[model samples]
Target chain A: MKSRDLFKKEHSDEQSYVVIHPLDDQPEQKKDLSNFEPMKMTFTVRLSLIILRVYLISMILLLAYHFLNLTGIIKL
Target chain B: MEEKSNKIPDRVDQPSTVIRTRYRWMQKIMLFLVVFGPGLIVMEADNDAGAVSTYTQAGAQYGLHMLWVLLLLLPITYFSQEMVARLGIATGKGHATMIYRRFGKWWGRFSVFDLQLLNFLTLVTEFAGINLATSQMKLSPDITVPLVAVGTIIMVLTASYRRWESITVFLCLLDIAWIIYAIRLGFSFEKITPAAISFFPSGQGITSSYIFLVIAVVGTTIAPWQLFFQQSCVADKRLRFSDLGYARLDTMIGAIFTIIVAGCMMIVGYMAVHSAIGYVYKNPAQMATSLGAYFGTIVKSGLLLLICNASILGITAVSLSSAWAYAEVMNWPTGLELKPKQAIGFYLIYILGVLAAAGLVLIPKAPLQLIIMTVQVLAGIMLPSSMIFLQLLLNDRELLGNEFVNRPWNNWINWTIIIGLFALSIILAVQVVLPQLFSS
Candidate 1:
């Protein structure tokens, strides 16, 4: 069978799929997996990323808010 | 049967295996070549017109005391970009789409908004550079600015990914003229060695002006648009996990080449500072002015060429990032594969970005200097949040298989970089606001 057909048959998901030609030199072990689903994160880890995101966004917003106030666009 | 065997050539022997192996190697090489442009282009594009100014300002204003900063950032640049490659290859999604999927709409929209705002402002700085360059050669902004905008529009509308990338890569290669011109103006390795190794700010570097310049340098090297641009480019190019190592190699080579070019830019200004005709610089253009005076018009043309190409390159990348990020967030069809007619929203966003920036640059007395510096500061403010998303996504084992995930030690190093950049951004914001709050 053609390698492209083999690729389609072995892994058909739209995420990611490697088209490993028959004669390529990559190792038999340690395949670079593609088409991966997001691994579920623990609550604590998820909260940390969320917190960092909120804090940084707030900082930028505060800066913007200050500019608006200085320009008398709104009184807060 | 004899005739068929003769035509087959490998019918009697074990040559089929060897032929297939060689053919396979050739195929792999070809694939690598085709996938090579995005990483290198994105990284080199970081050293765009704004970067040329920032690095030149850093060297001219503070000399080699800041050389070590470039050395320090080499790894940070590599680690940061490698995450984008990993995400693009594994999840097969653009950064915006991935953020929307993995996080939520709020964070995703925020990213898109931040990118387009900062990206448009950055494009203005790029056209300003083009205008400055072209005018040095007696070409008016009325002529050059609209010409560049039209050219940029045509480039994105090419609709063929490979053709567009080949054009970008060719421009990226021409950027090396900055270093070559520096050599012609009298760059000596012996003069560079001692200063290159200096590890901290010295002389006039302890002032607020120096501190602000340092942050600008960092911002120039590790801007937020890169994260979005590379991820989208990878998705558009259809890069799979097998291309991961090759992409990282391409990223590394690009980082090294750009840093070397940045270093040469610093040398160009530093030579003038130490020359018998030494004087303080009033603007980034002075680096060219001094070199032009000493070495003649060739130096000016060389500098102008680098500036114009760098600006044009930045326009392509920055505009595409805006288009791709916005389209992905809106769930609209977006890719270079789609004809301009097929992907109207995508092409529209790209065209509007260039046109708006071109219009802003044409405004008389528009304070281009402040606009440029403000965008850098704004990008610095926005970087940590984007990076937070990128890091979490990178470590998510499901998103990238365990084999491709960041290890524990990698997290430690990554966190350190995040904190350092976060701190620099705050300092930069303060300096821009107060100007002399901490200056000596």
Candidate 2:
């Protein structure tokens, strides 16, 4: 038995929503990132995102510094 | 493969009709059972191979002194995961898709790439753990690693979502054996009470070694993959807004049980400390062997089997998260319900992840130490950032709406957790990069 047929037999129920993409030419629900609207960057949201960016950069820099320090590339 | 329903079941107004009856309590219980898997599996699977070693080492070195830390972490774990459950139930989308859709391609791509790299590295460590555990039983990695790898793939490929979840949940319950084993090792409530109450190890103060181990415990408990795994799992399970309370309860129960099992593992480690040959710090496999020398074969075999089980759980959950996130971002078909023929890209990602990790572990001169160190640093970096994304997503009023958007108090608590996790991640990074810094 082919897996496509098996899938058809198995999902021949009210519970076939599990197939986000179909084997047949049924309608595509577009369960990907297509349907949702992108987040509207309000003032507070932009500030929060900036803070997150700063935090990530600072942490990554600190890690790099430590790595270089451990490798004897930089002192102090 | 025709989909009768266009979306994963998002029926928010269910079970209300089912509960308008004399058997409301029974109906509620049944509803709870339906919403149970994502939370419990994520939590138990969080206690992966790395966690087992960390807890056991804490026990061996400090006895029950660290029980308070685990206790402190219970609420933190519950709140963090509860928000994830809500987002998953509300959005009906995976975390990666939400990030990509909302945060734009740059940040989205960054998250997806980091998650794939970190999850794959972590999976390798899990397979290494399996090899180490089986070595205790004189089982060769050549045979066991590939066998378990194939088993994990088949487990996912051959089952429906519900069946896969049921099997995983049953495997999660087997950790109860650790609790029983802890009891058999002679842990009494009276014996652990004082240690549980104490905040720090008696007579050792706050040494760098102790601090490092403490940070390690924290890092192990809450990981980035967990954020991805649970949100995707909740979506995969198709939980609805009506099931939010039950899902929260499920997450809470999972958090409590995972911590208890971790505490039991710590007890096992503490008992190993008193063995005929006193506890010398080493890997869990050695600890099991040493304990077996005194307690007999059951101690060794039970610990090894449990470690192997932990590895299997870790591999499944971690690999699935990677697959789901990657496929979601690529707009490929994704779900356990889909046959291999139906969702080739998704299954390929999952299978390749398992096989690659397992194969790496089998190679004689694999650079496992470097891989482990990189995993640590990447995980340390990834965990806090993932939480930040989750926090922002949970707050998106447009996405979750007023009904599901986070309350102000949730923001406060989650921000606090993110900060605390940031500090732990930094400490972990330092420990990895400058090991000498923690030697004193």
Candidate 3:
């Protein structure tokens, strides 16, 4: 009876170890990276982008005029 | 591609077995390859058309007097960029995001605004160089400008970040010809080598002109966009704290390459053939004209190719920096990993930048030389502001943890650089705007 109980206890410990680490010998698993980035653009973000675009276009035009003036195409 | 596996171990326990160790070795090699682009690309792109003109002019007009400046910049560049690499790995975020989160939205917005404006203006110079080179080759602006614009857009749009990196790296390698050109010129090292070692200043007039050139070299060598671009690139590559050593190695290699290219450029120009004009290095094309008179059309062809390559490299990196900063600030999906259709706002900003810059180059009879010179000078004026922010962020313990704060020695070097750059900028300003005070 003593020998049987010792064997049972060792087996139970092994089982618990396996439970804790299911793939201790496994080499690889494909990572699930989906849903890491949100799909929807928030309203505030959309608004900021629009404002940025307007500012960008205005600057481009202003830059063009400045270049032309420097080159003598337009005497600013 | 950025590694998805770096964040996870293959086996939870006993992951370091012989076979797994081999696998991990391969993984480390791949990670290094992915992290390699931004540093080298940013460094080489610094050797852009404006930079070419400035360095070549320095050599031809000033001789090896400025060679010491290039040599000194080697370490200065390395330490400044090293902090960027550390920041990115520690935070896994772009410079813009960190600045915004840590320094308040107002400061963040100011930095971004400054970056975009300077980037846009700088892009003008790159396209201007492209226009000049292609025009000299008998390729009209109408054909060359649009084609380059389309080609740049397509290159960035169709490929992943890895692919774009490969293409730019290949283009940057073409600069090796400058070294060969220097060798062929048979640089009189017996004459200039001593001066180069002695940190001689080449004694150009101590007027605004000389100070302006000094500032231009510093500005173009350590451009502001480089800081942002490298940080974003580090985050995009998914670097972790463990990769800091390799990242610093990558940056060191870049700094070495940057100085070598600049050195070769100066050598090629120092020996350029010129008359009573006294080694005139007014512009890259003008320098080419003088060199061609002595060395034949081959000099022109070589100069044009180098300039064009630098311009294309600049356009891609600068526009990407803009797109990255804008997207990060607005909380949009970012990364070349995403499909264009998915990252519409991000990609749109990039395309807009390229097209707008190219379009400005199409302006009738633009003052190309004036524009390039002005842009580089303006860049020098604006660089100290960016460095201040970088210095602040790198020293922030809350952000980087205790292991990575600037050591006392590092702080000393940094403060010396900051003080030196600020002092020069101030002196240049006073000389330019209030010359009478200096004259007195």
TM-score of 1: 0.85
Local accuracy of candidate 2 as per-residue lDDT tens digits, B263-326: 9999899877865464695988888888888889988899899999999999999999999999
Docking class of 2: incorrect
Model 3 residue B437 distance off true place after TM-score fit, in angstroms: 6.3
The C-alpha interface RMSD of every prediction is: 14.8, 12.0, 15.1
Please tell me how candidate 1 rates in CAPRI terms: incorrect
For model 3, the superposed segments whose C-alpha errors exceed 4 Å read: A1-76, B1-31, B195-208, B274-279, B365-381, B429-440
Per-residue lDDT tens digits for candidate 1, residues B362-403, read: 999988977876796678777987888888887776655686
- Output the worst ten-in-a-row residue range by lDDT, candidate 3 chain B: B15-24
Instruction: Provide the clash count, candidate 2.
Output: 0
Candidate of highest TM-score:
2
Worst 10 residues of 2 chain B by lDDT: B12-21
Winner by lDDT: 2
For model 3, what share of native contacts is present? 0.05
Best-to-worst lDDT order: 2, 1, 3
Indicate whether candidate 1 or candidate 3 has the larger lDDT: 1
Global Cα lDDT for candidate 3? 0.70
TM-score for all models, in order of appearance: 0.85, 0.88, 0.78
Clashes by residue pair, model 1: A16-A35, A39-B398
